[model samples]
Target chain A: MEHRIESGADALYMDERDHVATALRDMKAGETVQYRNAEGLRAVTVVDDIPFGHKVAVVAVEEGADVRKYGEVIGRAVVSITVGQHVHVHNIEGIRGRGDLGSKEAAAQ
Target chain B: MMNGTFMGYQRANGDIGIRNHLLIIPTVICSNQVCNRIMQMVPGGVAIPHQHGCSQIGADKDRTFDVLAGTGKNPNVGAVIIISLGCEVVDPAALAEEIRKTGKPVEFFDIQSVGGSVKAISHGAELAKRMMADLEKQEKVPVPWNKLKVGVKCGGSDATSGLSSNPALGAAADSLIAEGGSIVIGETTEIIGAEHLLAERCVTPEVSNQLYHIVNRFEDEVQRMGADMRGGNPSPGNIAGGLSTIEEKSLGCISKCGKAPIQGVIEYAENIPDHGLYFMDSPGNDIECVSGMAAGGAHIVCFTTGRGTPTGAAVIPVIKITGNKMTFRNMEDNMDVDVSDMLDGTGSLEQAGDRIWQEIKEVAEGKWTKAEVLGHQEFSINRIGPSL
Candidate 1:
């Protein structure tokens, strides 16, 4: 569980299992940033200008797929998402405490 | 750091208090004005005025009585003055008797019995002045750090809250527990999505079951009202601050409890047992949560907020912590410590935790927090049922 701090690192990898990384600073579109996860050092280009404290998709997610942050399911994708895309309420839907757990049930489809 | 002690007022009941306050409490809402007037007339008198003393039945009325008694029993309060309207559901004499068990001075008066508001105010003020003077005479002695009970709370949370401040607070919580002190983390609403994580840490299966039961009961209450808990939580401010769901907010919220095995689960405003970490079933509202902790005998409170809030309890000092650098700078007057450096990699989590631990000792040693210095004595009781 080592996270290498490469040059120009702009986001924090909270946990190795987390599929989403948090932007430590406001990142510009197309900017490259280094992140260290359990798999070792890697880089992802920012497709959107992610605001500070916001999440970025470090792994591509399909529509209705669960989104993992802090190694727990924070929500599920409402539509297909790609790596480097900003992940938020616009493209993601919360699964926890949902009145219907519809997304969890929908994930099986 | 683990073996340190702080100067405190050691009460006859064997409880240690960090602050020696003369508390003026109103048994019913109808007596709020009289209590406030008494407080204004007497210097060094603190009053907690709230609604819901009349027309409350069942558990709701019991909660009001419990909170009032528990607050007066808080070790920080050196004495208590009770004001009643003489016809409220909560009897002033009964309330005074409950708090008297703590061996602290207790006095009571009724507006109706006293003849009118002016007479009641005058009578209450004179009693408060005498009590304040008497409390000031109490001497402070050295008390072990482990004897201290502190409440951990987070309000107006943001993305940075869980990431930096809350974990830092958790570390401090662990430190306190390791030294044999007690730390109680509350806000059942905030733990909606994170209950499983806490349940996994309970010392016994029964404790875990209690944890789940409280969370489920709260959810059921929300459902009974024909509303969704998610819609009200992660409030608009939380969303703007980058919290998208209750799970996300909860993941951050639970970090403040640290890694201690939960010793037990207690009802809101219940007496907080000494030692270890406990969970109090309470609301997410800042004032109400802090109020319950105070009533539960918390000598001090460590409140972490990312968006910043100026909330302090009537009987205890609240030390505010924030992880958002922007918020810390903008609300410097309200914030006590800033761990924003952890976000930019300028500081480590352990350092942030140590910083909070240091602030706790300083406050316990009679140092005033930003809220205390600003005179933010906010107090509000959480209600369970509607008024009849």
Candidate 2:
């Protein structure tokens, strides 16, 4: 959002949660660009690029703040995220999804 | 803008509507046939044959209740006559109460109350005639553009949809929003992977979260069905039209909402209270989805399609826009706006937006949408249940 580098015919889309994402890069184009994700301010570089319109784990989640991508709860970050970093299931985990038949039962317990 | 007009009925609830319709609402499936027969006897009434109203429980039951209430409350309806079987799980009185709150005259007759079908049909027609007569005396005031709440939707999508028709409609949506009008967008399942793009534009964190929740809810439901959404969410039709994945399909689907601040999310059939850009949690089922938006109070719907559709709401004017040259050419009779020039590179997005905006004014002023002129009174409310 700060600066636009060159995507080279590649389009970038924010995930459901607006963390730092590589959500939708052109898959077949091999055409890619880089951006500052929890790393350098005004950063522009390609790190974990994928196909056209593929998902990329986001970085830069703050404490207790939900990650935004794919317009849904992909996961919640356990710790803080810096700009220009990669966020995956490793740091972000389920908060609204069913790993246990939902936590309303756990809440009751 | 547009200086067009259509024959519409004015309602006491302070709503301007394009249709003066007597709707026969069946409280239960057992009464659907009776309702249909009543519609057959009446010249200007409409009937919805639904699978709900009985044999549903829990959220399924609640969904049916919402839809029933929503349908009866659509502003296009001048009057409503509920056809009931007397003892259904969803109460006809409660449904009638919801509709009556809109200040329209409503009458209900149970087939059991009249000893069967023939008597119910006879009674329903008579009530419809009286209601229609009362509605005829109403008049239309020059309602502002802001008073219009139109639903934005796309179906039978193609790649050109994202590049042309969808963005054009989105521009029109932005124009409408700028004019203080309301725009509602649905098809939650179609927006699976693209929810974040919309979330970033949310007016508030709460609205952002609602956008997140629906996408998550849809993903969970698809998972529960044990079939990958990648299978059907994009549909073979969509794939043939060039959308590659559910994510890709969704990326294009969200464009219809335009660049407006997200206000909030509403339940599938919940009333669209003073709309800005409202997202309704609904499936991509064309008939049911359009039905849901209609019931929720969209006076009109601007549906963009790349593959083409003949679907129309029973009451509201459904204006169809397409960017596919072949589809537009082949299905010329069904389409309202052929924005294929955008694909041909002969038309710019702003030009298409102006044209559609002009069409909107014309439609609002009472120009019959192609669907209306073709008598495409297609009506289907999402039936969230199994048959007994």
Predicted model with the maximum DockQ: 1
RMSD of every prediction: 2.4, 8.0
lDDT tens readout by residue for model 2, B174-275: 988887778999988877667788889888999899889888777676556645454375677775554545555677677777898888889898888674
Collision count of model 2: 33
Model 2 chain B: lowest-lDDT 10 consecutive positions: B1-10
List fnat, each candidate. Answer: 0.28, 0.00
Cα distance off (Å), candidate 2, residue A73: 16
In candidate 1, stretches whose alpha carbon ends up further than 4 angstroms from where it belongs are A1-8, A39-41, A100-109, B1-4
Specify the highest-TM-score model's number: 1
- Residue by residue across B1-388, what tens digits does model 1's lDDT show? 5546678989989998988888999999899999988888887788999986899999999999999999999999999999989998998899999999999999998889899999998888788888888888888998888889999999999889988999999998998898899999999988977899999999999999999999988766654555434557878788777787777888889999799999899999999999999999999889999999999999999999988898888989999999999999999999999998877777888889989998998898899999888888998889988878
Against the reference, the lDDT scores of all candidates come to 0.87, 0.72
Score every model by TM-score. Answer: 0.95, 0.77
Provide the TM-score of chain A alone for each candidate, in the order shown.
0.79, 0.48
